[model samples]
Target: MGLLHRFANPGRFLRLAARLQPWTNALALVLTGWGLIWGLFFAPADWQQGDAVRIMYVHVPAAWLASAGYVALAVCSVLSLVWRHPLADLAAAEIGPVGAAVTAVCLASGSLWGKPMWGAWWVWDARLTSVLVLFFLYVGHIALLRAFDEPQRGYRAGAILALVGAIDLPIIKFSVQWWNTLHQPDSITLTGAPTMSTSMLWPLLISALGFSFGFAAIVLARLRAAVMEQRLRVLLLSRGNAAAGAPS
Candidate 1:
């Protein structure tokens, strides 16, 4: 209730986003640039895997966001459904393609890394299979949201689908553990501490945070555009109505 009221007004959201956007964009740029330089140049190569291990810097973060973005989409869907906030629906719709792109990057990079390390381009492993399903879910959401002539109906249906597809998120997380797979287990989780050394893990963390904020900034920019477009549509419709009512 309180949350809904705070952001319900487009004016308020626009102001808040305007202020936050610069900070987020700056932070994303700095962190991503530093992370990439450190990962690609300074970080020690794997003794066994050698240069191929560099791919993890990008692959791991993309895989993480592929699932995390959907969680965000689901939350926005719930807000749109229960509170009927127009901005929430717009944000969710705008976020779908970004999430899909990240998922594809994760899969493509993973395949490239696999060829040298695992002796094949791809295998129907549990983790790989579930991530593929996640990709399809993103595709379905985008398709369903644009399927109807009435935009609101399409958004409503898409929200329902987003919420339902969220169930697969947990499955994707546990797929590697639940099955004996070739993919390495999670490095960041397993015990009280991360499995990697500070030198390796720090850059990965920075890069992941950068990617998250980058996604947010893009979504906010798209949402702002959507709001303005809607406003223009309303203005045109009102003018058309007035002209039709006048003596001709």
Candidate 2:
């Protein structure tokens, strides 16, 4: 508990994040590129769906990150409200739009993949509807945070919304199992075996990992920018005040 607070300072976090960003960026680029090439060309096509299944490498990662990002935002919001950690608030705020973007990608990619498989572009399936709602929640979170003149008020509102919106996560995760749906059940699970063979699975795993790291790199960079902007604004405001108080 005591050690965790040591990194609560924005300066220390900024230094740590700066040191880590380059490695993460390079890794994201390398791994994602490798996964794309491997999945598209090297991996065997699906016996049923053919090459269209290759789209899973992209769609699955986007969908995974979209949900994971919101969970992160909610946890950060909890820390912000309970501990009043400024960095937590900043992280949550930055995650909102990124999550939304990924969710949109997931939906778009899924629709594209579904058109041939399902003979339709979309259906109001449980999983799809819930993910769509999650996207909307992210957008609302971003908008609410920017709606107020006082930044703290906006943060408070956004935090509450994030916490409340967390109810959707479990529903999204369980939707295919709990109800009749056009969406398929889990292809991979922890307790059971993967439905896919090694050739098909490796590229998907690599893509997912690369995208996850990419998300972290982007978020850390955004957090650093927000911290810098805040510091700059404070410095400028202080200078303006000092100049106003000085002799003409």
In candidate 2, stretches whose alpha carbon ends up further than 4 angstroms from where it belongs are 1-3
The estimated TM-scores of all candidates read: 0.95, 0.97
lDDT of 1: 0.88
For residues 33-129, could you state the per-residue lDDT of candidate 1 as single tens digits? Answer: 8887888789888878998988888898899999999998999899889988768888888889999999999999999999999999999988998
TM-score of 2: 0.97
For model 2, residues 16-45, the per-residue Cα lDDT tens digits are 889999999999999999888899889999
| Colliding residue pairs in candidate 1 | none
**Considering summed lDDT, which 10 consecutive residues are worst modelled in model 2?**
1-10
What are the RMSD figures for all models against the true structure?
1.4, 1.0
